[model samples]
Target: MTYVDGFVLPVPEGKIDAYRQMAESAGKIWMEHGALQYKECVLEDAKPEMPEDAPETCKITPFGKLAGTKDGETVIFAFIVYKSREHRDEVNKKVMADPRMQEACDENNMPFDPSRMAYGGFKALVDL
Candidate 1:
C-alpha cells in the first residue's frame, strides 16, 4: 500500500501567489524524490468541526465542506503519496537534505507561520 503525508497551514492573505510558487517548486522536488503524486489545493469551503488530531478544529475544514464556500479563510493543503512507508522514508531523507529544501529556510520569504503548520504521515488504508 502507498504511504501518504498531509499538511495544512494558514498562508497570509495576500501571499497566495508566493505560496503557490513555493509549493509548486517543492512539489516537483518531492515528485522527483519518489513521491507518486503531489497535490496542493486552496481551501474554497470550510466548516466548524472537531477532528481527533486537532480537537479545536483550528482553521482547516474538510475538503468536502471546503468545496462549497468562497472567500473563506484559505488554508493551503498538500499531500504526497509514496509506494510504501520504506520508500517514503528513503525519499524524505533526500528531500529534506536537498539544497532547494534548505534554501526554503529563508524566514522572510515564507507566507505562513512555520510553527503553526499542521502535518502528519499516514499509511494508506484505501486508494479507491
Candidate 2:
C-alpha cells in the first residue's frame, strides 16, 4: 500500500502566491528525492451544506472550519505520496538532508502559521 503525508492549514489570501511559490520549490525537492506525487490545493467553495434530513450528530466538519480559517484566510490541503512507509522514511530522510530543503524550512519565516497546520502520515486503505 502507498503511504502519504497529508497537510491542511490556513494561508492568508494575500500570501497565497508566496505560499504557492514555496510549495512549488518544496514539491520539486520531494519529487527529486523520490516522492511518487506531490500536490497542493486551495479551498474554493467556503460553504458546506448539510442535508436537511441529516442528523445533527451525523454532521461533518468542513476543511475550512477544521483549519480554523479567519476572515482573510483560506484553507490549503496538500499531500505527498510514497510507495510504502519505509520508502517514505527513506525519501524524507534524503529530502531533509538536501541543502535546498533546509533553506526552504525556516519555519519562523513561513507564509502561514505553523502552529495552525495539521499534518499526519496516512496508511492507504483504498486505492484504485
Candidate 3:
C-alpha cells in the first residue's frame, strides 16, 4: 500500500514566498530520495461553496480553522508519497540526514511556528 506523510501548517501571510521557497527545496530533496510525489498547496478559499440544501451539520472544518491560522497567517497543506510505510521511513531518514535539511532545522529558520504544525503518516486505504 502507498504511504503518505501529510502536514498542515500556518505561515504568516507576508512570509508565503519564504515558505514556498523552503517547500520547493524540501520537495526536491524528497523526490531525489525516492518520494513518489511531493506537493505543497496554500489555502485559497476557506469557505467553500456547498450544496444549497446541505445540512449545516455536514459542514466541514475549513483549512484555516483546521490549521489554526491566525489573522496574519494562512495555511499550507503538503504531502509526500512513498510506496509503503517502510519506503517512507527510508526516504525520510535520507532526507533528514541531508545537510540541507539539517540547516533548515537549525536556528529555527522556518517561516512558521513548528509547534503549531499538524502532521501525520497515513496508510493508503483507497487508491483509485
The C-alpha TM-scores of every prediction are 0.77, 0.91, 0.95
Question: Each candidate: how many clashes?
Answer: 1, 0, 0
30-115: candidate 3 lDDT, tens digit per residue:
99999999999998997887798999988788989888888999999999999999999999999999999998876468888888
The predicted structure with the larger TM-score, 1 or 2, is 2
Candidate lDDT values, in order: 0.78, 0.94, 0.91
- lDDT per residue for candidate 2 within 1-128, as digits (tens), equals 99999999999999999999999999999999999999999998788888899898987888888999999999999999999999999999999999998988898758998889999999999988
Per-residue CA lDDT of model 1 for 1-128, tens digit only, reads: 88999887766657788888989888988988889999988766455566567756465647533422234336777899899889999999999999998788677777767876778899988877
Candidate 2 residue pairs in clash (backbone atoms < 3 Å): none
Q: At residue 54, give the lDDT of candidate 1.
A: 73
Ranking by TM-score: 3, 2, 1
List where candidate 3 sits over 4 angstroms from the true fold: none
| Cα-lDDT of candidate 3 | 0.91
C-alpha displacement of 110 in model 3, angstroms? 0.9
lDDT of 2: 0.94
List the candidate 2 regions with Cα displacement exceeding 4 Å: 50-58
